[model samples]
Target: MALMDGRDQQHRPVALVTGASRSAGIAASVVLTLAQAGWDVGFTYWTPYDERMPWGADPEAVTQLSSQAVGHGARTAAIEVDLSDPHGAAGIFETVERELGPVSALVLAHCESVNSGLLDTSIESFDRHFAVNTRASWLLIREYAQRFLGAHGTGRIVSLTSDATVGNLPYGASKGALDRITLAAARELAHLGVTANAIDPGPTDTGWMTAEIKDAVLRSTPLGRLGRPQDCANLVAFLCSPGGGWINGQLLHSDGGIS
Candidate 1:
């Protein structure tokens, strides 16, 4: 029961963001950012996945994010659906279009990041990661292109990615897959004027970063402190802008100076 992203003057554009379960997370920031930039936003979230997280779940977070976005003067919609379902993308697009408008931009922000190392990773865990993080994105992107095929000359697709190589096996590996998959998506959508890219937002303090972890990240990052959710949202806003149209099919490291 929450709502909208980009549109022309006659109709505002609508940005659909997935994984907006945390008020303190990037999805929440992206919602506000796009709304400020004049795009109605339609964001999606799942409570079950977030319920098991260290920070626990807040079903109210999505509603709050929606209210905040609307307070900024943009129409908003909050879809509480599980992205892991194969039919999820179809339903999401249908609902967003029905309530918000045509989705001009897609931000695949929903992901399952359990702290499982290689030794501790299970087939079920790995499969779940792939289902939610990779398969869902693939389906959403495909649906996005097909929805506006040959009618529009522009669209934006931004997928969240990570550089985790070892400690976070399943989540990291699935994010890597998402990054590669985006390349193909970009190529396929180039003729239609849509741009697809991925961003690895360094180590953000979304409740997972402890004092020690923050200190460790600070040493590697050029910036003194941990990144904020707004940092990721800012880049995404730019990437979806007219000025960012030239850069496509690439993974830009929005991770400050963390190398």
Candidate 2:
């Protein structure tokens, strides 16, 4: 693994994106978008999570995604780790910094989502959700804020959130906690000049939605279509850019007015 030289490193800011285990996911889209936007990209993925899901893990996702980013002329690093471990955040940052450089942007797109209702959700399931979605996110933000050496007003933190809580109790509840943790950073890390915000990309069909679910979403959504990973990626890339500096401390909905 070769590090970027001083000149190249200085010009292209590094963005660390989580949850890019599969090519179809939003994190993969964010990585490609940021790469095209002139940012060196480092991303994380946990294969076990995907294997447990209905859509099994794609073994070559990281390699293929890295190749795509390199084609866009961006330096890239892909780390595979379980975010449930309490100490995972520090190791992730250490590896990315050593591989690329100091990260200017942190994108939290990783999640452990299993659909269980309030009545049937187990204690272990609930805890795991919080562990990956809430606790891990807080730790990641803390690590980013502490180690951030970017120019003032250039640091960015963007977290993906959801509002679906009816049948998906644990996933939604943990995401709610994540939203607060991320928004708090916008104010708490103000002195560091870091802008933190959460996004709710409603009803995105990242291989989880069934045909019936897709039709229901389309009928309710005025656009009559499902949200795409690229839509959310576009917003993330903008938020990391200098132009999105002013929008902070708020949960923005980029779900095509699906609220």
The per-prediction tally of clashing pairs is 18, 0
lDDT of 1 at 110: 89
Instruction: Judging by TM-score against the true structure, name the best candidate.
Output: 2
lDDT of 2 by residue, 135-207 (tens): 9999999999999997789999999999989999999999999999988999999999999999999988789
lDDT of 2 at 230: 97
* lDDT of the candidates, in the order given: 0.85, 0.92
In terms of lDDT, model 2 sits at: 0.92
lDDT of 1 at 94: 91
Residue pairs that clash (backbone atoms under 3 angstroms), model 2: none
Ten-residue region with minimum lDDT total, candidate 1: 1-10
Candidate with maximal lDDT? 2
lDDT tens readout by residue for model 1, 162-184: 99977899999999999998888
Clashes in predicted model 1 = 18
